[model samples]
Target chain A: MAQPIISFNNVSKRYPGGREALSNINFTVEAGEFVLLTGHSGAGKSTLLKLIPAIERASSGTILVNGQSISTLSGRGIPYLRRNLGLVFQDQKLLFDRSVFDNVILPMLVTGQSHAESTRRVRAALDKVGLLDRERANPVALSGGEQQRLCIARAIVNRPTILIADEPTASLDDEYADAIMEMFRSFNQVGVTVLIATHDRDLIAHSSPRVVHLQRGRVLDKATA
Target chain B: MNALIRHHLHSLRQSGVRFASAPFAALANMVVIGVVLALPLGMYLLVSNVQSLASSIPTEPQISVFLTPGAAKTDVAALENRLRAVEHVRSVRFVSREAALASLKRSPGMADVISTLRENPLPDAYVVTLGEGSAAAAERLESELKGVPGIAHVQVDSAWVRRIDALLSLGRSAVILLSALLSLALVAVTFNTIRLQILTQREEIEVSKLIGATDAYVRRPFFYWGGLLGASGGLCALLLVFLAQVLLNRNLSEFGNLYGVELRLQFLPVADAALFLAFAALLGWVGTYLSVSRHLSKIQPR
Candidate 1:
C-alpha cells in the first residue's frame, strides 16, 4: 500500500487565551481516502484542517504530508506546499470584486499556468461546477449554493492532489448540500483525497463515510464505514 | 522564468486596471505629487537661470589706474604699456584728462555742471581689464598695479560682481534645501497612498495568501501601482514647469526689452527631466516596498 497522503502523530494546538484547540491528535489519511471530521464548535476541527496547509502549526508533534515533515517548511516553502492542496472554507471566501471566471483562474495564475492553458482549464473547472454560463458574472451576484460551487471550482482549478474543506455545506439547503456532497464524491472517485470537517450528523448518517469525531480538544471516536 | 515574466506583466496590467477604475482619485493623487515636485524643481531652475544671467553681464570688472598729478602724456603712455604687460592685465585703455572731461560734458545732466568748473580737474587714467580669475586674483593685480611709479590710486571694480556671485551661491544652497524637503514630502505621499491601497485590498490580499500566493505575488501589483502613480506625477510636474516657463518667459522678455537686455529663461534639461522621473519612480517603489513588506506580514490566512 502507498504511504498515507497525510499523517499527524501526537499533534497538539494551543491558541491564544490559553485554550487548547487540539490535544494529542493522531490520524493518518491515505491517498484517495475520503474522511469526515465531525465536532461541535471549538472542537479543533478547523484547527486540524488549518494545520495541513501550515496556516496553523501544531504546538507539539509531527505532521507528514506525502512523506515530507511540514515542521521543516519555511516561509518560502509554504506556498509550494499549499499549491498542492485544494482548500475550501465554509464562508465561501470568493473575491466578489472579480468575475466568477477570474476567481476560478486565480489559483492557476498563482501557479503560473500559460494563458491559453489557464483559459481552457478555467472553463473546464467552471463547467464542472455548473457555472460555465455565469463565468462573467461577479461572485456577489451568485446565489449561496452557486457561490459555494464557485469556491469549489476555484479550489480544484489547480488540480491539487489533496482537497480539504471546512464545513463546506453548513448553510446550504438540503438539496444544495446533497449536490455539493455528490460533487465531492465525483472528485474522490477520480482519486483526489478529500477531508471535510463538519458538525452535520445527518450528513454522517446519510453518506456513511469514515467518521472522526472530536470533543473539546481530543478525539472521542473514530468509526470506519 | 516565463512565469515570472507573466507575473510582472500581470502586475502591470493590474496597475492599469486599478488606474482606470477611478481615474479622478488617481489624478488627484498624481496632481498633489506633481505640485509638490514642481515647487522645488521650479525654484532650482529659477536660481540656475539667475546665476547664468548674472554671469552673462559683459562688464569686464576692471582696475582703474589713476595717474599721479602732473604726470606727462609720455609718462601715462609708458605706464599704460607697462600695465598691459602685467600677467593679469588683459588690456589697458588710456583715458586722458581731456577725453574724460569731454565725456562728462556729454552726460545728460553733467554738461552744465562740468562747464561751470574753471579748468579740467580729472587726471589721466588707464582702465585695466583683468583676465578671467577670482576676486583674490583681482586683488593681486590691484596690488601689482599700485606698485607702478606713475600710478596714484589703484581701484578694483569687481565689488558689484562679487555681490552677485555671493547671492547666486546662496540661492543655490536654498534651492538644494528646498529640494530635499520636497523629496521627503513626495516619499511620504507615496507611502500613504500605498498604505491605503493595502487597507482597501486587505480582503483580496488575504484570499490570495490563502490560495498559495507568495509574498512577492501579493506585492507585485501594488508596487507597480505606486511606481505608475509616481512616474505619471513626475510627467505632470514637467508639464507644469514648462507651462510656467512659457508664461514667465513671455513677461520676462517684455521686461528684457525694456531693460535693453535679452533675457533667456531655461527649463530643466532633458537629462534632468529624465532623472526626475526615474527618481520619482524610485521613491514610489521604495515607499511601496516599505508599506508592503511591513503590512503584508501581518495579514495571514487563519
Candidate 2:
C-alpha cells in the first residue's frame, strides 16, 4: 500500500564513448524487502547499484529513492542521499592506514555524530558484524572475509535504511560466504532493506528472497519469493 | 552544535597527528617557510631602525653665510638683522673673524697653526637656523642669501640629511618588493606540501567520499594542517629575526662606540608579530584551498 522505497522506471545508463551499461530497467523495492540481483560479470549489476546512489547518472528515465528523484539531485544533495544508503563495493574499500575501528567510524564522522554516540554505535555495529574484538587491529591484518565484514560494519554504522552490496561474498570459502550471507540475513530480519548483487547461483538458490535477474544490460526476470 | 565542535577538534587533532608522524619532513617545510618570510621581515626591521636613528639626530636645517674679507663690522651686523627678518628663519648668530680665530686657537692642534698667521684668515660669517627643517625651504633660503650684498657663499648644511632620507625611502620600497615575492614563495611551498599529502591519502579521500563526506569535511584536516604549518613558520621567522637582531646589535654596539651613539636594533613590535602570524596562516589557508579544490574534484570513486 505504501510507496515503494526504491522505484526505477525505464531507466537507462550509457557511459561515454557509446557503451550502454543498463537499458530500459524497471524495478520497485518495498521498504523491508530483501532482493538479490543475480547476473554474470559485465551484466550491469554494479552499474545498476551505482545508479541508486547517483554515482553514475541515468542516461534516460527516472530513479526515485525514498520518493526523491535521483536524476534531479544536485551535487550537494548526493552526499546526503548517500548518508541514508549503505554501499559495499566488490573490492572491500577499507582504509588500511587506520585501525578497523576507525574505518568503521568514518560514516559517523562524516555525518558529524556526537563522539560518545558514534563510539557506541560503532561498537554496536562491530559487534553485529562479529568484529568487536578486532576493533583496534589494522585493516591490513584482516583476512579477506573479515575485511568484507569490516566493510559491512562501516556501511551499516549509520543505521542506513537501505543496504546495497556488490559481490559481498566473492573470493571467499563456502564457510566464510555462508557466514556473511547469514549476517546479511540477520540484518534483513531486523527490517533493513537489503539488495545484494552476486553471480553465485548456489548462493542465490539458498536464499528465499525476491530475485532480480539481469542478462547483459537488460532485466531478464523478476521472480517473487 | 556539540557535534560540530567535536568534528572540528577531531580534524585539528588529525592534522597534528600527521605532523607528528613525519616530524623531519614537517620541520624542513616549516624552516623553509621561516627563512623565506624572514628575508623581508629582516629588511623591514633594518629600514625602520635606520629611520629611527636618523630621526634621533638634530634635524634643524641651518645655512652658513660667509661675508667678504673686506666687509665692515656694520655690514656684519646688518647681515645678521637681515637673516633674522627672513621668513622661517628661527635665529641668527654673527661670528666675527677675531672670534673665529679665538675659537680655532682653543683647539689642541689648531692653536700653533693659528699663532703663526699674521691676520685672521677666516671671513666673518652668519649662522642662520631655520624653523622649518625641510630641505626645499633651506635650499630656497640659501639661494636667496647667496645673492645678498657682502655675502660670498651660502652653504645648506641639511644636504646630507636629505640624502639619508632618500636612501631610507629606497630601502622601504625594497622591503615591500621582497615581501611580496617571498609571500608568493610561502604560498607555493604550502601548495606543494598539501598536494603531496593529498596524494598519499588518495585512498582515504575516495573512501570518505563514498561514505558521504562533503567536500568541506574532506578538506577540513588539510586546511588545519596548512594553517598550523604557516603559524609555526611565522613563529620560526620571528625567532630567526630576533636572533639576527641580537647578533647585529652586539656588533653594532662596537660600531656605535666609534660614532658615540647607542645603536641597538629593536625586535619587531607585538602587533606586527601577531599580524605576521595571521597573514602567514591566511596564506596557508589559501594554498590548501587551491590544492584541495583543484585536485579533489578530479578524484572520483570509480
Candidate 3:
C-alpha cells in the first residue's frame, strides 16, 4: 500500500481578530486519492490548502507532506515545496504577455529545465490538454473552459505528485464544470493525488469520493463504523 | 538553463517594451549625472588653472627690498652682492636712485614734474630674489636683510603670493564639499530609477521567484542597467568637459593677451577619466543593488 502523501494532525489557525479559522483539524490523504473538501464559506477549507504549501503556517500541531514536516518548512523552502506540489486556481493566474506554450512551461522554468526539454514537455502538455495548435495564442483568446484546462496543464507540466485546487468549478457552468471534473478524474485515475475544495453540492451527489465536511472551523462529518 | 533565462528575458520583455521608454529614462538619468559632476569638475578646472597662473609667476625674483633714501649707490651694490651670497638668495639686482628717478621721469605724466624737481629723492634699492617659493626661505631672507646696517625697511612684496595660497586652500575645501554632495545625488538618482523599475515589474519578479530563480539571477539585468547608466553618464560628462576645454582652448590667445599669461586649458587625463567612469559604475551597481534588495524582499508569495 502507498503511504499517506498529506497528513494534517491537530491543525489549527487563528486570524488577527482572534477568530479561529481551523481548530484541531486532522486528516490524511493517501497516495493517488481524490479527496473533496465540502464546506460553506469561511469554513477553513482555503486555510487548510494554504497550510500545505507553507503559504500559511499552522498555529498549533503539525502537518506533514511526503514524510517532511511541512508545518516547519521555512519561507525559502516554499518554492521547492510548491515545485513538488501543483496548485491550480479558478481565476488562472497567468502572465498575460506570454503565449499558451510559455504559460504551460512556467513550472519547468522554475525547475531550471533545459530549453529543448522544457519546450518539448510544454508542447506535449498543451497537446494533452488539447491546446497544442493554440500554443502561440494568448490565454485571453481562449474560452473560459479552455483557460481552466490551460491552468491545469500548467499545474501538471512539472509532474507534481500532489495537486491542490481551490474552488475549481465555482465560476463555471454545469457543462464546463462537468468537463473540468472529468479532466481531474482522468488525472487522478492515474497516480496523481487530487485534493479539491468546492461548494458545488451536485458535484459530490453522484461521485463516490470520501467527503470531509466542515462547519465554521470544525469538522462536522463522522465516518460510520 | 536557457529555458528559464529565455522566459525571464522575454517574459518581462513585454514590460521592457511597454516600458521600452525605460532606456530613455536611463539616458536622461545619465545626462543629469553628467551635469551634476560637471559642476564641481568645472570649478576644479578653473581653480587649477588659476593656481597655475599664480605659481607660474617667477619664483626666482620672488621678493623686493626697497632701500632707504640717501643710501649710497656703491653701498646698495655692496648690499646686492652680500644678499646674493646668502644661502636663501638666488640672485640680486642693485637699482641706483638716479636710475629709479630717471625711470619715473620717463613716464608721460611724471616727465614735467620730475624736470621741475631739483633733486632725486628716490632711494637706491636692492632687489632680492629667492631660489624657491617656500615660507622658510622668505623668513630666512627677511631676518637677514632686516639685520643689515643702514637698511631702513625690508618689504617682501610676495603679498600676492600669500593671497593666491589662501585661495588655493579655499578651493580645496570646496572640492571636498561638492564632491561629497554630487556623489550622493548620483547615487540617489540611480536608486530611485531602480526603485521605480522594481515597482513596475513586481509581477515579473514574482514569476521569477516562482520559477526558482535565485537572487543573483534576478539581479543581473538590473546590474547591467544601472552600470550602463553610470558608465554612460561618466562618458557624457567626459564629453562635456572636453567641450569646455575646447571652448577654453579656442579663446586661449584672447585670454593670454588680456591676462598676459598663457591660458591653455586641458582636458582631464586618461587615468582620471578612467577612474571617474569606474567610480560611476561602482556607485550605480551599489545604488541599484540597494533598491532591488529592499523592494524585492518585501514581496513574498502568499
Candidate topping TM-score: 2
Output the worst ten-in-a-row residue range by lDDT, candidate 1 chain A: A216-225
Estimate the TM-score for candidate 1: 0.90
Prediction 3 global C-alpha lDDT: 0.78
Q: Name the top lDDT candidate.
A: 2
Q: What C-alpha lDDT values do all the predictions have? A: 0.87, 0.89, 0.78
Each candidate structure's TM-score, on Cα atoms with residue i matched to residue i, is: 0.90, 0.93, 0.79
Docking class of 3: acceptable
Q: Kindly provide the TM-score obtained by chain B of candidate 2 when compared with the true chain B.
A: 0.86
User: A1-225, model 2: which lDDT tens digit per residue?
Assistant: 755899999999999999999999999999988899988999999999999998899999999999999999999998999999999899888888889999999999999988889999999999999999999999899899999999999999999999999999999999999999998889889988999999998899998468998888999975441
Q: Candidate 2 lDDT (Cα, whole model)?
A: 0.89
| Per-residue lDDT of candidate 3, residues B1-302 (tens digit) | 45557645643454345436667776688899888878777777777777777777764436667777766768766787777777767667777788989899776568888888888877777777776656567777787778566588787777567777788879978987997888788888889988887787777676666544556556766776777667777788878888988887878968676745556876667897899889877877888888887877886555
DockQ, computed on Cα atoms, for candidate 2: 0.74
Local error of candidate 1 at residue B295 (angstroms):
1.9
**Runs off by more than 4 Å, candidate 2:** A222-225, B58-60, B67-70, B93-125, B131-134, B147-149
* Superposed model 3: Cα runs more than 4 Å off: A206-208, A222-225, B1-24, B44-61, B64-133, B143-166, B207-223, B257-262
Candidate achieving higher DockQ, 1 or 3:
1
lDDT tens digits, residue span A60-108, model 3: 9899998889878876676777788878764567777779887887677
DockQ rank, highest first?
2, 1, 3
Candidate 1, residues B1-302: lDDT per residue as tens digits? 49999999988999999999989999999999999889887888898898877777744568887888887768777776777787666777888889989998886668878878999999888887877665566778788766677778888887677788888889889888988888788888988998988889888888888899999999999999989988998888889999999999999999888755678789888999999999888877887888887887898987
